[model samples]
Target chain A: MSIQIWTFILVGITFAIYLSIAWMSRVRDTRGFYVAGGGVPALANGMATAADWMSAASFISMAGLISFMGYTGCVYLMGWTGGYVLLALLLAPYLRKFGKFTVPDFVGDRYYSDGARVVALVCAIFASLTYVAGQMRGVGIVFSRFLEVDVNTGVIIGMIIVFIYAGLGGMKGITWTQVAQYCVLILAFLIPAVAISIKITGHFIPQIGFGGVISEGANAGRYLLDTLNAISADLGFDQYTQAFGPNSKSMLDVAAITLALMVGTAGLPHVIIRFYTVPSVKAARLSAGYALLFIAILYTTAPSVAVFARYNMIDTLNNVAYEQAPSWFKNWEKTGLIAWVDKNGDGKMEYRAGKAIEGKPKLTGQTGIYGQALVSNKVVDSNANELYVDRDIMVLANPEIADLPAWVIALVAAGGLAAALSTASGLLLVIASSISHDLYYRIINRSASEKQRLLLGRIMIGVAVCAAGYFGINPPGFVAQVVAFAFGLAASSFFPILVLGIFWKRASKEGAITGMVLGIGFTMLYIIQTKFLGVGNWFFGISPEGIGTVGMILNFAATVLVSLVTKAPPQDIQDMVESIRTPRGAGLATDH
Target chain B: MENQDRLKEYWRRNLRLMLVLLAIWAVVSYGFSIVFVQALNKIHLGGFPLGFWFAQQGSIYTFVGLIFVYVWRMRRLDREYDVHE
Candidate 1:
């Protein structure tokens, strides 16, 4: 079968399974809609959490980023996985014990103030929207490339499918569908990795193959990292297998970025809410462990994939004659993602370092200025023979680059779609619950009936989906960049407040509110100035990605300073904190 | 008075365990991977530089192990304090 037909068949089958699950598990009450009735089993909830956590960034863009950035990319791998440790030990079980329907529930009740709840609601909605926009864009990219449709049409199709499952089934439906998504995405990620590993190192395991010596090729008997390092040096890039020091990304920047990602993962309302779906506090703790184990399966494999994909691209394209290029090269070129200019009129492509030459001859009525076959539109640079290859193509084009079979490429398309859809549904649920449960039921209509709240939740999901789809069509940045901003905002605004509310009994409503406002305010201002305004030189040499760590520090300082001056929380609130610290009476949501 | 002391003791032990485990997490991810990375790079493990392996692969495996260890110890602690859920 053709690759396009196979993609359609696999994607169609997966969508059908998701829709059926959504139909069967249709939510009946506010509890089901908001928290999946708080009855999801540990293993199943673990799978759901893994799916919810690994968004399009993890599935599609992470390996690509790692391939280009090399060792500096370790910040993402360590930061993301390490956060689960904090969640399992410091946050998850405690939140499950204090559980209501949403993150705001804890903030509101713990501080004994509706003011704090509103702050948390706003943060949750803001962070989740930023994250979900990236997921929607990812879905559109996969659809447009594989299904041969325009980007907007592809986005609309994805929005419709997510609306069906998320709007109808709520958390209950989303949970089951996520379990299926985890299976598809993991298999899709692994098959290519394993195949390439065996091809390179004669090993079945990618982890071992990463460090094994290549058994064939010109680099035979040479260690994989040794070969990659030599190739990178020849291309004027840093070694692929060494840590960044004074010459590259600073140690402080690495430390700051890693910390920000860890805290941000713990703070994300969508991921934290996954813990509330489990039946018991013990299950919440155990489920985090299971979730990490599941997430690790992919996290560990990504670096290997990055190394192999980098090697393949360099090996195939370096110094090759333009006319002798492979079919895959031409296919990617038509999409405008790969461009080359024969500056010396040598009729050969040069893949090297430094800036491409500028202002070459136009291709209107001219021929043979460079080559008879090469046109101006195909060559972006005129003066120098430079090749521009987009980093995002690394993973999507990996199978073809390795000459893997067509069916494997089709499976990758399905996997990318599954990843984006599952995460989009999860984030939309958080946004919907924050509006319907926190803003509407709790504050606006304190006496709203269960049916009214359920109806409102569904309505909010529809509206949120439309907004996310619009952003996907006009994405502000790349998939991983937008996600990094989401993480930064979440780390700054929610993480410090949540930690203080539980761990410090004297934390007051005034302090929490002040802390959240200042934290989010500072982080947003930094991101806007640097990202959109093109401002150079961040404060203290920290990148915008690591500025959230500074914001978090300011938040903690503000909270602590404010709380010391203010009166302590009420006796009941203090006692509530004490009870949440223990594991007893955790399954039931009671206020003692 | 006796019940209050037992509850206090349980909470204290839990906090102590958390402190100890979190310390390990920090040392592996931040300390080995970043702060001491240059020093560790002098040593090679298989085909990987020691610090590079810790940053990219070893830290993740340690995180997974840390979580399971926390769960197992917490379960036993809960039972000892009659707080098992």
Candidate 2:
């Protein structure tokens, strides 16, 4: 069967499963909509949290980035997983004990100020919107490539699917669907990775295979990392096994990026809200452990998959004849993701080091079946490399690259859609609830009925989904880049406030409000100045990816300084803080 | 007075345990993986440089271990404090 037909069948089946789960778990009230009625089992919530946390970036783009960036990419692996440690220890149980439905709810009540709640609401909306945009774009890419639809149409289709589940079941619907998604995505991720590992190292476990000796290649007896490093060095890239330091990324740069990612992961409202669904503080803690364990299955495998994919691409494409290239190469070429120009008219492709060549190559009179130019303008310069490959293509094309069966490739398409859809729905829920519950019900109309709140939540979901779809159709940047910005913003705005609110009894509402504004403001200024205006060098050599660390520090300082000068929170609020610290009587989530 | 002392002691014990676990977390990720990476990479662990392994795989395993340890110890702590729910 054709790949498209297989993709359609697989994708269709998965969507049907998600829709059915949504229907069965349809929510009845605001609690069901917000925190899944606080009855979710720890293990199930763990799976759902894993799905919610691992977005399109982790599923589709992380390995690709790791493949290209080498050891510098360890920042992502360590940073993302390590944050769960902070979450489990410092935050999750207490937050659960506090029994709040939303992150902003905790912030608002703990700070005892409407202004603080409003600030948190804006932060949640900003972070969630930025995040959902990336998921929407991820959905668009999967549909456009696999389902053979236009990007915008694919986004609309994805929005409709998300709307069906998220609007109907809210958190309850999204949670169950996410459990199914976790299964699909993990299987999709693992099959190709294990298959590639077995093919390369005679080991089925990717983690061990990463260090195993190559079994059958000419490099037999060479360790996988050694072989990869040797090949990458031979091709003028840095050694794959080396850490990023003065030669490439500075140590401080690595540290800063890692710290920002860790803190950002903890601060994300969507993931934090997952803790509220579990029934008890113990369950909340256990769920975080399970979440990390599930996430680690993929996180540990990603580096191995990255090494194998990079080795495969470089080995197959380096100095290969363009005319004799594999069918998969030609297929990807038609999508304009991989391009080559016979610069020397040697009719052979050279995949080597150096920047992409300047100027466009003359196109041959070749047209695809869709009546589009088969090979759009090839970018060629006087460099040795004649091919320009998009980083996003690494995971999607891995199975095809290795000549895995069509069904496996089809499963990948389904998996990608599942990953993007699950995260998009989670983020959309965060946005919807913040608007409906925080802005509409809490602030605007304290007397709004449950029915009215539910209605507003559904309507807000519709609006948020459409807005996310718009961003998908017109993406401001690459998927991972946009996600990094979201993380940075979340770290800057939310992490410090939440932490201080929980641990520091004297943390004043005025302090939180000022800290958030200044932190977000500084981070935004830096990102805009660096990313958009291109004005000055990054401060302290921190890329915008790591600027959140600086913002977080500033937030801490501002909060501390402001709180020291301001009057302390009242006696009752201090007692409330003390009560949440102990793991006693953590029942169903309720407003204080 | 007795109840207050018990609560204070419980809080103190929890903080101490957290401090110890968090210290390990910091050492593995930031210390071994970043600050002392070059020195650690000079030592080999099978096919991987020690620092590289710590950055890519070892630190994450330790983190998972740390969390489980925390959960187990905290569970016991909750019981001791008569706060388990």
Candidate 3:
């Protein structure tokens, strides 16, 4: 069969698997709808969580970001995984003990206020929309490339698949389906990478290959690190080992970004909801550990892909002329993802560093100074000056660049779709829960029956998926930039409230409300100004990246100061705090 | 009631172990990798910069280690709590 035909069959098989799973696990009660009947095994839940968490960003964009950023890309590698540790240690078990179906449910009950729940609901929606945008786009990209369809058509098809399973099966279906997706996406990611690594480094293991000595260097036994750094510097970029800018800001930026991602990942409603699918507090904790282990498999290998792609890229075009650039180069150039300008009207291209120093005025972003334009204007002489590489194309292009089989390329397409669809489905689940559980069942119709609540949840999932699909078409900006806003909202709102509720006996409802309002309010204002209004240049000296860090500080201060001013949490609430922290009664936590 | 007390105590021990592991987590990612990366990069590990390894490989190994520790300890804790499956 043709590659396209086979790819279609693969997608059909996966979709059928999802639908059948959802069909078999149809909701019999509200409990099954919201928390998957609370019966998922710890290991299965872990795998599902990994699938839900990895998303399009992890599957498609991350390895690409690392490919060019070299060592700097390690920030994402460390930050994302470290955040899971924070989730497992600080958040998951207690939240599980709270025995809620949604993130807003926890916030509402723990703070003993509906207003706090509303704030949490709003934050969850905001973060979910921003995140879902990327996943929808990821779905579109995979469809556009392999399925020979427009992004919008792809999104519609993706939305249908999500609606069929996610809306019908609820948490139960999503949980098991995510496990299947985890297998598909991981095998898809690893097979090509392992093949490429062995071919290039002559080492069978990717991790060891990344560390092994360069085979043909002047220093034949030179370490991979030294060789790569020299190559990066030769290309006019900073050495892979060298630090950028002043020490203080770099430290602050790294800390701020890492903290934002950590707290944000832990606080995200979609991720938090996964914990609810487990049977007990201990199961929640174990699921988190499993999720981290599953995630680590991808995180560890992503760096290897990055290093390998960079080396392969540099070697391919090192001395080749613009006219002789490969077919992939020309194809990518048409997409504006990889551009080569013939500065000075020269027929050839020059890949040297000092060339960019001559022509253009450097752009000063609202934040600190961007490094000198990485691209030089000089036409590369037979040597391509600098490749204008877009970060989004990295993961998609890696397999093709490695000369992997066409079936492998098709599998990568399936993997990317799986990653996108899995996260999108998870986010849609959160959106549904917040509406059906927190808003409808809790406030709007407290007396509603299980069937009504389940119906509402399904309707909400469809609406959320459609809204997200619209935004995916006209993405607000780069995938990372848009997702950072989600991080900021998460850092500011959910993290502070959840932490204080669990750890501090003195924390009050008034304080929790104040913290969430100010935290989310400040973060929203900053993101709106910087990304939408273009007002970042006027007020703060820095960009939107640093706003979450500031907002987190504000959240903490507001929560503390208000708690001191207001009445302490009631004795009962304080007792609840003690119980969640104590971790006793792991199996006996009540639905009440 | 005594089973509840044992379960609570089991939880307390689990929390204690997490705190220690988390401290190591902070030191590796924030302390060595981000805050003092340049200084550590000045030192070498197997010809690779120490900070680079910490950022790319070292922190991940620590994460995996923390997970196994948590799982092993928690299983025993479950047994102590009389909640073992």
TM-score of chain B of each: 0.96, 0.97, 0.86
lDDT of 2 by residue, A262-379 (tens): 9999999999999999999999999999999999999999988898888878777778876667777778776766777666667677777764544433345585332323344545
Q: How far is candidate 3 from the true structure (C-alpha RMSD, Å)?
A: 5.6
TM-score of chain A of 3: 0.90
Task: Judging by DockQ against the true structure, name the best candidate.
Answer: 1
Candidate 1's C-alpha runs over 4 A off are A245-247, A355-385, A477-482, A588-592
DockQ of each: 0.87, 0.83, 0.52
Candidates in order, TM-scores: namely 0.95, 0.96, 0.90
Listed per candidate, the RMSD to the true structure in angstroms reads 2.8, 2.4, 5.6
lDDT (tens digit, per residue) of candidate 1 on A1-592: 8889999999999999999999999999888888898999999999999999998889998988898778899999998899999999989999998878889889889878999999899989988998899889889989988889998888999999999999999999999999999999999999988888888887889988888888887888998888998988777777786677334677788888899999999999999999989989899999999999999999999999998887777777777877677777777765555666666667777776554433432334333433333335544443343676666677788777767888888989999999999999999999998998889888888888888888999999999999899999998645456665788888998899889988899888888888888988898888778877889737877788888898899888899889999999999998888888887877644222
lDDT of 3 at A354: 36
- Indicate which candidate wins on TM-score: 2
Task: Give DockQ: model 1.
Answer: 0.87
State fnat for each of the candidate structures: 0.89, 0.76, 0.52
Candidate 3 chain A, run of 10 with poorest lDDT: A365-374
Sorting all predicted structures by lDDT, with the top scorer first, yields 2, 1, 3
In Å, residue A2's CA in model 3 sits off its true spot by 4.9
TM-score of 3: 0.90
